[model samples]
Target chain A: MSLFTQSISPETLSVATLARIESQGGIDPFASPSHPPRVSAPSFRLPARAISAITLLALIALWWLAAQYKIVSPVFLPGPEAVFRKFITVARDGFVDATLFQHLLISLGRVFAALAATLLIGVPVGLLIGLSTVGRGVFDPLLEFLRPLPPLAYLPLVVIWFGIGEPSKVLVIGLAMLAPIALSTAAGVRAVNEERIRAARALGASRLRTVLHVTIPSALPQIFTGLRIALGAGWSTLVAAELVAATRGLGFMIQSAAQFLVTDVVLVGIFTIALVAFALEWAIRTLDRRLVPWSGRD
Target chain B: MSLLELDHVSVRYQNAVRDAVADASLRLSSGDFLVLTGRSGCGKTTLLNVAAGFVSPSSGMARVDGQPIAAPGADRAVVFQSDALFPWASVRENVAFALRMKGVPRRERDRRADALLARVKLSGFGDKPVWELSGGMRQRVGLARALAAEPRFLLMDEPLGALDALTRERMQTLLLDIWAESGTGILMVTHGIEEALLLGTEVIVMTPNPDTGQQGRITRRIPVSFGRRYRAGEPVRAIRADPAFAAARAELADAIFEGELQ
Candidate 1:
């Protein structure tokens, strides 16, 4: 039977069932509490290293088949071996007076700095708006107006304000990042259980203390959700910002290579972006796991 | 002197045409446990909120210890029917939340919280999150949280009404124990007539709203000492064997369901 249905009051029976499901005395169906239990007795599960080799072989076969048939032009879609050679050439020769490492580092630094700036401004503003009616009243109209305007839409203004320097790139990224974090924090704050707030007040908590202890803590799960969304936006905005003005970042490299019809190099840049985004998400998920272990049961 | 007094208290919501609670007056003195038994929406919870100072009465005085009650404070703790334990917090942290709000040191808070949990018979489950507990266990945590504050007045709104028959009975007994130990005057709201009789020093039978003015009152006080020592299983046997217990229970049930006797 489906766990949730509109017919049954989930609040009544499901809550009780969920409570029983989360109980500590019983082991999770999937995870064993004691001594790293196996989900299914391992049937010689291949390591990623082994799987990578198999994947490489499969790709090579597909590439060789395509090349042999000439269904696609070699110039447009290079074979796996040809791409590997290009990768080696780039690793050896470097591009635009900078190595791949330098390009990657510059992009990473820009994104990180932008994200940091977004967090510095967005979180506090979100909290202020979220916690008090006055703050929300003051800021919500402005935010609603701003939230819909694309981060790129503010490009000309930001360029005029800060110039096309690293700061401007960071500012653009931060602006893009801000909405998700601030909006999410506000949502999280609003969602904090009212009962907990009352309970805290009853315990003699001053207004400020209650916000700090009860409201923030209870809102944490939702706050992290907002952070993840903000990070994704920040990453996208960073790439867009880099493309517009930067001479040396990954986005610039891709744009420059595309102009020269160096498709292989452009592909590499795109792959690098995908890899970086994945890593950032992985790190955030790890942090979320540590911070909100209770979310795992659901 | 009255320990807590609501003099002609009235509350009307923004959208509602009539008052939710209108000119309701109640006086709860020291050592008195008042149970307000009525139908749902009979304004028992609203009255409790007015007493706790969460809801402002439109035009009446609500005073505790001769001081006017305004915003919610540690002086009047409430145990909600929903249990309302912070889902993010472990059982210990949930109980200790009030103490933490009171600026109790972490170690002291933990110690006091542990004792409170033990009082509710939730000793080993302190580290478990509120979500990890049974409905009854969560309610126990709510009870523990209210008790941890050591409030001057306790306001319980059908706190044990959400539980099963067995757990509800156990909690009623637990509540009596806590009340006796603390001597904090209680104003509980429950629908169960038997529960009101078992727990209250005075049972107030509130008539449904739109007909609210002065409604119901029963003043045959239950002797606090009668069932203090009896465990869960023993109470029914002993109480039923006593003829007076049956009579008082009948009287209370009648007062709640039927019209009050003046």
Candidate 2:
């Protein structure tokens, strides 16, 4: 199955790592006197993931019972089958001149595009706040001002300044993301082990070389965390930005459905967004595992 | 003049009421293994940091052959108490970090790093990440990395402090071996009186100055021969077994305890 359909979660990653390590016959890297010995068998632990799965089933059963009993109006809370049927129809035929896949693709495009822009702008800003007193003096207050601002709070102001266009949409999303990326980058830079920097200095590294080789690499895990947070912010602000103008995105699809009180279609859109967010988290986590493998291990 | 000297060096940190190291005089030569031992508040580490050029003396001079030390250089490489290794790099890469900073070629650096790792007896473990290694192994990597700089004086701040007792003993032997072979001037700081006596050609016990209320000052200096005895084809346990070794440890311990109580 594609990553979007995969039921990846936080708990599974650790279990998978443990299984891989045990399979290789190496003792657990973190095994200590306090830690109990590993089972050395396999990944399927009953109490571990089964509880979440059961909880999900119970919630779905409750939803079905409530729908069947007409406890809430159908316009507000549709049955699961109705939502599923709407998902199929939207995937095959078009919903508001675009299919479900098209809406999803456009939404992903906007988020990723905004993500690219934010990364380009945010990383250097973060480094500045981290590296020099002057950089911190200039940028720290700006970031403080920008952070904690709701995307909706800035929507009208962005629209007024940049005009209602693709730039404004991307701008709005990018603004929401810049603070997390920049702030996390700065924190990571500041948190780099003091001795590591001192070691670099004593080893004939020039100031610039020390930053490029030691400082940047040391700050990478934190930078990646910032990116993940920025991506999350992008997803959250996606619908708000799309609600502004001409759009063929997931946010627009959900908003369009809500206007007509198409509760089933709205549920389907919401579910798709949630699933896609999970997929994004999984993809970034895999990337983090590959790129910053030393993060938590130390 | 000594090759490295802390000539009555004293340091008072910003906003501090007293000096960390108060008018402390110490010296080490190319073949000397000098150990500074004291209570927790005593500036054994602060004194070492002065020699390493990490901290500047507030009222006294730190010098190299009377040149006056200004900044840290590869001439004096330090192995920190925490081992302060780069987690992002593999063992070989971490070992070669000094060479890499010197614009050495990748292949030559790798070759030299592997040789150094082997010197530390971590052969075939060059490709491993630092965290995968045991504490003792990581300390070895720190030593190997310091050696890669080919420093004239190898300054260590309790480099084996985090290791288990057995590992710490093994590391003490390795350090003595390195000192004899490389002839690098060694300045080390430690709390273990036995460790100081076992490894130091000259051991100094410093006490926090009661007058200054937390400033460190050297109170006693003793020249010992166990490190030299270990060098003279003597086994470590044999040197430790000697009555002289116990005597020196007792003297050092007494000084530190009295310093602590004061």
Candidate 3:
């Protein structure tokens, strides 16, 4: 008898082979590699966290030394302490007659509003494109045209169309965020396994039920990936949007501070944007782990 | 009365010059186990798909209970070779999916799913994710899911094609037991000659159409009674080891080979 047939039960052999394949970083036996893996129960990685913190502190120290030693002019590169002081000042006295929180909130509000709109409109449109040839014919060319154009390239047109107001700013950011969400959702829908769809149909699922229950759930991981990408794109576009026209927002605050050569305030704005963006990504990643736990494992 | 029937069916895909399935007719009544055996591209699957209502016949008709098959419905369930259980759902939930789709209440669906799982020898495995199951277990789950729909006719396309020899034997026995207990008509397509003789109440041998040079036409229909012996109280292993069984299997194999040569 073959070794596979001789020693152990076939079930055990198959399970062992699957585990071996998984250990080798082969395709997951349970989930597709494209989907997210189930999250393991939370465990503290204090050593890794310490190392990350140390690296950040070391970079900040190097920046401080370079500024203090005048290796780069303080006017161009403010020290971390200077930025910290500016943060306090901005919190107390405000910038451009708006408090720091107000600026932060306004920028946040714009990006989030755009994100919400993208999810609402882009997801359905993307699903349509992914599921049906007619939907693809209708929207593919339009999205293709929009996707490659940089947000700034269309900023002038947006301002002209919507005027230099909240609508214009929101519109630009929304447009910037829309493509990834739609594209990813479409990709996700298309990526749904043919067998799964067939199984659903065999189980007496209507076309609508198959799309809703099978297609939507299968496409969720890719959609989450798109959401992450769109959030980043939207944040970057917020700066450009504010630069064009905005009375409030961190983007406006930084641009206005740059005119006065207030390098400290500019640095603070940049750091705050980075921090918020990082937090947003982390939150989404955590949610993805919880929501689509069946993604990348076998 | 036939549970499912295909009358002189031919399936020709658009833009294809010849039919995939040509002038093939089949009937499956309750408690009947019909196995269609042929080599690849013989259009056995296309015929199955036609009967399942996934594909409409280009020229002829497929019906269930005298009603024309327009599309896929709950009356006919398919078990695929891939064991396409939903990875996102737990074992119970996967089995319960058909019930849920049919608007069965949650409590009843769970009860039916659990009972089906037990019938398939997967009791207490309800909460386990499908991906974690072995190939045989997955196929069992797939079978349970198919049964959950309470289908009148079970159509399988190479359902045990992926399993190892031992697992395949085990699955064959399991299939027999399920068939005896459920009494649902089964129409399965496979390439294995021995599998056909061993499991089938009637074996239909398909070959390329001699006249049209198309993909498939039924060449022979052989009635088998050995499987009923197992139902009549003989052990499967003894039945398999019997000389009569071996003779039947060899005859079927030679017949299929002769068709291939022709």
Q: In model 2, which runs have C-alpha deviations exceeding 4 angstroms?
A: A1-49, A69-71, B211-213, B259-262
On DockQ, the candidate that comes out on top is: 2
Question: Better model by TM-score, 1 or 3?
Answer: 3
- Please report, as a residue range, the 10-residue window in candidate 1 chain A with the lowest summed lDDT: A1-10
Model 1: residue A141 alpha-carbon error in angstroms: 2.9
- iRMSD, model 1, in Å: 2.3
Per-candidate TM equals 0.82, 0.88, 0.86
Per-residue lDDT of model 2, residues A1-298, tens digit only? 1122121132332343344345446675576677567778777658856888898999999999889999988889998988898999999996999999999988888888899999998999999999999999999898878776778888999999989888888888888788878887887789888888888778777788888888889989778767776787788888888989946988999999999999888898999988888888779879988987877667
- The DockQ-derived docking category for candidate 3 is medium
C-alpha lDDT values of all predictions: 0.75, 0.85, 0.85
Q: How many collisions per candidate?
A: 0, 0, 4
Q: Arrange candidates, best TM-score first.
A: 2, 3, 1
lDDT tens digits by residue: candidate 1, A177-252? 6766677678778867787688778778888998888787766765676677667767766556876668888887
Look at candidate 3 and give me any clashing residue pairs: A29-A298, A30-A298, A31-A297, A36-A296
